[model samples]
Target: MDDVRLSLREWLILKDIESALRRGRRIGGLLRTPRRSIWLPTAVGLLVAASGFLMVAGIRTSDPAVIWAFAAVWPFALLQAFRLLCRWTTPHGISVKASR
Candidate 1:
């Protein structure tokens, strides 16, 4: 995370927020507005579904391509499964910490 750099717009936004708060204006509520994420959910959904299909196909056949696909996909699928399980058992709106 420390290696990551903010883009120009993000840096400007942070600066603006800091300046606003310094002037004693109530500007924090502007952050609660949801920004549009047009493709993120759809992309993740597709990736997970493809991973599941690969895992199942690899287990059912001996094709080299299927084996390669499974190798690439299984770890992501397993991690996603664990995340989903945690979300299901944990209380709503509480974020779970993943171990390093």
Candidate 2:
């Protein structure tokens, strides 16, 4: 029974270490990818642009309250565009580039 308990503890510790190592490797890989970081910003920009266009085209709704809501959300599109532009201009080796 004692031996069994010892082995179980050892197994658990090994599993923990393995999981930690895998997480570390994943983080390292993320750091290595130059385009990973910019995906969110690009998506946000597209969403904003789409929403703004919808508002302008009167496709969203004619209600003044709804138009105001769309207008309020318009800045996110500009923010996303700025983020994408920055990511594109940043050097490849930098952390910012890795995320984009």
Candidate 3:
């Protein structure tokens, strides 16, 4: 019957996808997309890097002003990085509601 044939085809497609995953092949590579997706990660990377650098500099430097300024900025950079990461990873269609 046609139903059996369609089920078999779907099973074969799933099996192929499983094989590809086992082979360490990405689905993204299999289906080429035209979308650009680099900037957010780059920004996050820069923010984390800057936060680390500021932390180290604040620790090592003897000047109080320099230490205080870096201390203020570092946490903000880290928080921004975390926010960007969360935003980038969250699914577009799902809306999160706060529990009362």
Off by over 4 Å in 2: 1-38, 57-62, 96-100
TM-score of 3: 0.45
Give the alpha carbon lDDT tens digit for every residue of 3-98 in model 2.
Answer: 555488898998887667657955655445355565677598677777877687665457777677677777777777777777778777566324
Better of 2 and 3 by TM-score: 2
Q: Identify the leading candidate in terms of TM-score.
A: 2
The digit string of per-residue lDDT tens for model 3 on 34-72 reads 344687678778767876776677778867776777787
* Ranked candidates (TM-score, high to low): 2, 3, 1
Encode model 1's per-residue lDDT on 1-100: one tens digit a residue. Answer: 8899999999999998777775663444333343434454455577788988887888888788998987887677667666656555766534444544
Model 1 spans > 4 angstroms off? 1-32, 77-100
Of models 1 and 2, which has the larger lDDT?
2
How accurate locally is residue 27 in candidate 1, as Cα lDDT from 0 to 100? 41
Cα distance off (Å), candidate 2, residue 36: 2.4
> Which 10 consecutive residues of model 3 have the lowest summed lDDT?
27-36
- TM-scores for every predicted model: 0.40, 0.47, 0.45
